[model samples]
Target: MTAVHYWRCFCGILMREVLRFVHQRERFLSALVRPLLWLFIFGAGFRQVLGVSITPPYETYILYEVYITPGLVAMIQLFNGMQSSLSMVYDREMGSMRTLLVSPLPRWYLLLCRLLAGVAVSIVQVYVFLAIAWAWGIEMPPLGYLAVLPALVVSGLMLGALGLLLSSAIKQLENFAGVMNFVIFPLFFTSTALYPLWRLRDASPLLADICALNPFTHAVELIRFALYLDFNTTALAAVAAATAVFLAAAFYGYDPARGFTRGKQTA
Candidate 1:
């Protein structure tokens, strides 16, 4: 297809995703509620028990809520990304995904368009959560809001790519619940989301190493540093590499010759 045709397709797909999000008020509310509960309920409870030392990005001691704000932001994106993949599975079952695949456009490009759309939706949710956090007195540097956009986009893409990879593997809607339990909770809890790496180390060095190796941890760290207007080359590099690998695997998973689609056809 021509460039204009490609652009039109991309726009159409993105708009569809956005509209789907808009129509589903419960989805929006649930996304906001999950992290807010963590910030208000869990963080409040943990503040007294958890003593955070003066870390690099943090100048002095910080509240637990403040420390986990970025992680909550990342969490919003993480769940939204998986939700987008759930929609993909639904679309496949309903035959809409097949229709999308039958288009003349390259499969990878179509998938990328869908990925970008999901990322866009997740970014909006992140900012909304940030706004609520600001209202709740979880403050960051003023310019930090603007500075963190790139990190948000990268992190959103990484998580969304992971969702896409999962969608390609999960053939039926019935199987998704198992995948969510197996994948989402483990990734979130194991990462530096709810607690610091040091805390994990205190518990178990092996657990800390696993958290360090988690791509989601790097995504959270990238956001944390950006929110403080600081640069973390290591986190940035790790997230970038993870995004690349996840996207490649997702692309392969959707490939018709030997991927999920092939399995679907044979079955």
Candidate 2:
């Protein structure tokens, strides 16, 4: 196919996702609600309990709300990623995925388009959360707004690719929802999203090690630093590497000839 054909395919997939998001108003609301609750309610309750010392991202010590804002943002993207892949499972059962995959476009390109579309949607949700938080007095540096964009894109892609990988392995719609809970809760709680690694290390050294190794922790750290107009090189490298690994695994899983899709095809 020519460049025009590729462009058209990408646009078509993106618009469809956008339109789906628009019609499913609850999806948008739900995405915002979870993080907002964590920011306003949970953050407040824990404000006194959680003491965040000066970390790499912050010059001075910060409030619990301020410290967790980036984590909440990452949380939004995480949910959006899983929600996008949930749709993938639905499309597969409904046979829409097969139709799209059968198109002349390369399978990998098609999957990439789907991933980008999900990232675009997640970015919108993230900015809206930031705007609301800003109004709520949780402020970041002005330039941090601009600086965080690249971080968001990379983190979103990494998380969304992970969702894509999960979707490829899931065969039925019903089972995927259970798997989401199984995966999301562990990934969120075990990471440095709510608490820093040092704190976890204090509680249990082994738990701290797992949190350090968790890719989600790096994603949160990446956003946390970026929002303060700072950089975390280790976080950047870890997130980039995780993105590559997840995406490569997703591509392999979607391979109809030999991967998870093969069983579906045969059956």
Candidate 3:
């Protein structure tokens, strides 16, 4: 395809996702409400007593709300990624995805467009959450807002790829909710999203080790460092690697010959 063809395809897919997001008012509300609840209700209680010790990208101890902000942002992207992929499952079942896949555009490029669209939506949600947090007095450094964009893009892509991989594997839309809960909770809770690795180490070394290995933890750390105008080579490497692996596997799983769609396509 020519450059114009590729550009138009990307825009069409992105616009479709954006419109869908706009019409789904509850989806937007729920995305905001979840993080807000954690920030306001959960954070208020914890901020008083659960002071975080000095961590990298942090010079002094910070309140629980401050410590968890990046994690909450990552949480938004994580949930959005899964939600976007859930739509992929719905579209595949409804035959819309198959229609799109039949287009002349490359399958991987089409999927990449979808992934980028999801990342864009997640970034908007994240910014809105950050705005609310700012109003509530959990402000980050001004430049940090600009600095965190790249981190968000990378983290969003990784999480979105993970969701895409899961979508390719899941056969029924009904089963997706259960699978999301199974995947989302473990990744979020087991990581440094709510608590640091040092604290986890003190409590349970095994859990700490698990957190260290979790890609979600690196996603959070990457955002955390970026939000303070810092770079985290280790976090960046871990997340980028996870993104590549997840995206590759997702492409494989969507392949018609040997992937999850094989039986259905043959029938």
Candidate 4:
């Protein structure tokens, strides 16, 4: 009975997540377009100005669009992860999250279900972005492309869990945009998204170390290696460590005693 109930609850949560994105079709397209614009339009212009070195398997004058594809993919997952969690917070405001929370299943299971849904949706957007990149002359081996699916899933889970943690910590939706703008942009820019770590080292050693410590950097590296069908040990470890930390902190944040839901939870 426990197994039956868990599977059913998982399906329910997944369905709810899919419905939310499906109903807001424009949001998905907008998400895809924003990055593509950055890659095709902005990155193209910046490539001439920004100093970037040739990383392995990229032996010639590579376009910035080609270089940043992995990082851009990471960006999409991270943003979507946060967006999904923000939606969860909105659901709480509208009295829907309480419905899920008060269900017979464990809270962790429900949370995982939601996280998995976010991952599934993220993968779809990622592939769409990849197809666009391919057409734009940004080529990678076909197997390299297929192998990135798991990394994307892991990254989506980690970021989505962080979002869930943030949602649980904040009091209301009003504060989310500030958090998004102030928090997300800094994290993205500081990472190896626009350039490699060595490039940042030349810019400022302090800045380079900060980027090294950033979990998002590791996530970016993880995707970068997977895109090239290479494995980065440091990146895998970092993602794993971040996943553990975020999940723990998020679990604590969601605890009733922590006042995460406060007056928001009818449960």
Best by lDDT: 3
Query: Judged by lDDT against the true structure, how good is candidate 2?
Result: 0.93
**Ten contiguous residues with the weakest lDDT in model 2:** 258-267
Q: For model 4, give the 10-residue run with minimal summed lDDT.
A: 258-267
Give one digit per residue, the lDDT tens place, for model 1 in 127-176: 99999999999999999999999999999999999999999988999999
User: C-alpha displacement of 42 in model 2, angstroms?
Assistant: 0.4
How well is each residue in 194-228 modelled by candidate 3, as lDDT tens digits?
A: 99899999999999999999999999999999999
- C-alpha TM-score for every candidate: 0.97, 0.97, 0.97, 0.95
The lDDT values for all models are 0.93, 0.93, 0.94, 0.85
Across 147-185, the per-residue lDDT of candidate 4 in tens digits comes to 898889888888888888888877789989998997689
Task: Report the lDDT of model 3 for residue 241.
Answer: 100
Output the TM-score of candidate 3: 0.97
What's the lDDT of the predicted structure labeled candidate 3? 0.94
After the best TM-score superposition of candidate 3, give how far the Cα of residue 257 lies from its true spot, in angstroms.
2.1
Instruction: Assess the local accuracy of residue 120 in candidate 1 as a C-alpha lDDT between 0 and 100.
Output: 96
Q: Which of the predicted structures, 1 or 3, would earn the higher lDDT when compared with the native?
A: 3
Candidate 2 local lDDT, 111-217, one digit each (tens): 99999999999999999999999999999999999999999999999999999999988988889879988989999998988998888889999999999999999
Off by over 4 Å in 3: 263-266
